[model samples]
Target: MAYLTQPDYVKYICSCGQLKPITSLYFCRHCLKIRCGFCICHEVDSHYCANCLENMPSSEARLKKNRCTSCFDCPSCFHTLSIRATLVQPRQASTEASGDAKVENKQAKKMYYLSCFNCRWTSRDVGIPDQPVASGGWPERTNPFTTRMNQLLEYYKAIALQEKQEKLERERKKFAIRGKYITLTDKTGLTGAMARNIAGLPSTDGGSSSAIANFVASQASEEVEELPEDVYTKEVNLKQITSMAQRLASPEWQPAEVSRLHPLAKLLSVKRSQRCRACDHNLTKPEYNPGSIKFKIELLAYYHVPEVKIISHESMKPGEKAALLVKLTNPTGHEMTIKLLQPEDVPIVEEEEQKSIEKSLEKSLNLEKDSYSWRAICRPASYSALCRVREVTRDFTLAQRDDAAEYDDDARHDADDVIVWRKSNKLALRLEVETEASAASGAPARAALALQYSYRNTVPPAGNQPHQRNHTLYTTVLLDLGHVI
Candidate 1:
């Protein structure tokens, strides 16, 4: 069993030169390389409310400012607010009778109020009336600055349209030097807002000559409202005042006193998908449902790469050789031929297409040497962790992972020099490490191991390549030794 508090003793070198644990790394079958978060692209797949498990389209979410209409959060504690029902009894008057004719109804009507279980806060505490319906009947407060905000939004939209027009006109002249093509905008009588509408952009102030002509500037007052006289003499209570965080949570009013605090609308959560920047292939895509914990497509490094675990190791001393035991497991269904190589002896292979990417990056970087290129440069100086380690090479073959093999107790023993034991798809190897004579005492003796293994790529017929499958891949892992005694 793995402990949550344990340190990351083994780290893999990502193709983007980042050193990350297996949990955070992803494997791209198309590129046959390991990728990290820094070398991938993320895009929003869906928007949802975590509290209510409600999903909405991105366009609607944007229009609503990414807030859930039914779900609410506690203004005091920020916890999810639950609907609590209350009963009320009132007298009803007969429609055809005189003013004195009234009927008493003991039957009660149920109303719902938002309540926070964690903080004992309720909607009635802030003077909000109970809702008739539990889900959608809650009253929405109008923003005091709504009119001004709408005016500003339209003003900016008009300005953006004007700038887009100027940019297009400039680009047209720059490209029209061949004198072959003329745009419909120049031929038709459309102008200003109409032309912007034809280009799929917003109309400019509904054909107004200028936005400033319609915009009304706010007036400044010379007189100021003074605070109450009791404010200076009254004793301050910290509990009655809202904290900075509570004020910022509801920015519309930003009430300062606890009495003015109201229930906050719950912010919506979004599901995102990540893609490899190099190949434009999705690395991870989650299910659209908010309640699901699974993903539609997940390419984690742990599933593709072989896992290595330290079993035991002898104490190390300066200028002495020590024995190290490590167990390797083949996670893939296909048999893998694993070869261990020295850190510096491993070769990095790139396709002709990827090589061109390097030249393009170099051109963008002004041909600076030693400076890291974009996606083109994967293995960086961080891989030098292996260069500091000294170890011998070992080669072995692991069987394919079989579900029925786990039930068989009998183990297979190999006669190889490094093979210690074999059970199913796992192989335990006895590795020897030699410490430097001049190595400082009490310093950690690090060891680096590179694995060149056969991988059966299952990514079928992606883009133009239909037969690109089965390849040899290289990955480097680093281990930390306690210290030289």
Candidate 2:
């Protein structure tokens, strides 16, 4: 079994100079380059409640402060509160008071209250009443400073609007230029207010625009409320008080005592989609359903790039070459021809080629012209030091992956000195690694390797040019050998 927490023995160098494991990288087919988390754009797709599996639109989510109405969290233990039902006996009138003998009838009413399964905390702990319905009939607390908060919000909004108008006027004055041709409005001497008056339309200026209310500035009072005498004289119980986290969870009241803590509305979770900044293609996108773990598009580097794992290596000494064994697995459906070379031996992508690739990405900035946050995508090339490997050693071929190949009996194989063993899509190799003579004892044993492999581009015939598939791609990886003995 793969260990959940293990140090990375093999790491690949990404196009943007990042060294990451195969699992943490993404492949952009449009740009034919590897991208990491730092080079991708994240966007929120939907908001949802994990426990209730209730989905909400973005607007509704914002209006509700990103909380689920029917679900709640335990204010004591912060666990999901489950609804418990109980039978409540109704009150009945006595026959002696009515002066008539009668058969009294009453039915038990079922009531629901929130309880935490972990902490054994119920609504009765905080003196909350049980509800007749199982969900969404609980009374909500009203904030004492709601009026002040609204006034502050309106004041800030109006200030922002005033600042925005002033900035627009400044920008207009700075960039203003005379047009070559005179407009009919300018030549006919018709101003905006004059035109509005002539057309019998209301002028969109001052109070005529909308009902702009004047915000009352809050006043500071000199007198302070006296604290309870028990706060200073009486012994305090920490168990009956709320912690900082519990208080901040409900910011409106921020109750300091346990009795004031109420069942908190569950915060909503979001499903986000990731896109490659350079190619403008989706790297990973989840399904719209909150319960689904599947993705609509997942271009993980592990699926596109070959995986290399260090098996074993002979103990290394200064100035001596050590024998290293590594296993390579082709995760693709097609057979791959891989050659080991020094990093410098890899082909350098020309400037013209890079420009052509960017041109092929063909992202139009026109669509984002009005977007305030939009900016041109700029992808930086990988910065790497050439590996010191001596020679090519030799090239080898790995067979295509076959699920049924695992069931078949061991097949006949040719004996090769370089290849240690051969399986369905995996091959093991014995290679040499050299350590520097002047290297100190317990120094790190490191080696950089470049792999030249034939890749088949699956860029379909979508926009332009015929689909030309065959291409040779190059990747550089760094290996961490055991420390020199």
> Whose lDDT is greatest here?
1
lDDT of each: 0.79, 0.78
What lDDT tens digits, residue by residue, belong to model 2 across residues 224-321?
Answer: 99998787899889998899999988889889898888999999999999877666778899999999999999989898788888999877778888
Candidate 1 C-alpha lDDT tens digits along 1-485: 56988877778888767777888899988777788876666679899999878999999999989999888889999999999999877667455456666665567889899888999999999889987888887878889999899888877777777787789879877876453657665555455667687799976445543664687877999999999999989999999999999999999999999999988878989999987766678899999889998999999998889987789888777778888888898988999989888767778555554565456445543334423545545556463231133454656788999999989999877786688889999999888877777777777767788888889987686467667567888898887767778
Model 2 ranges with Cα > 4 A deviation: 96-103, 162-177, 180-234, 347-390, 406-414
Could you list the CA RMSD of all candidates, in the order they appear?
5.4, 4.7
Give the Cα error of residue 130 in candidate 1, in Å.
1.4
Candidate 2: which pairs clash? none
TM-score to native of every candidate shown: 0.82, 0.83
| Candidate 1 lDDT for residue 382 | 60
Give the worst 10-residue stretch by lDDT in candidate 2. Answer: 369-378
Clash number by candidate, in order? 0, 0
What shift in Å separates residue 194 of candidate 2 from its native position after superposition?
Answer: 8.1
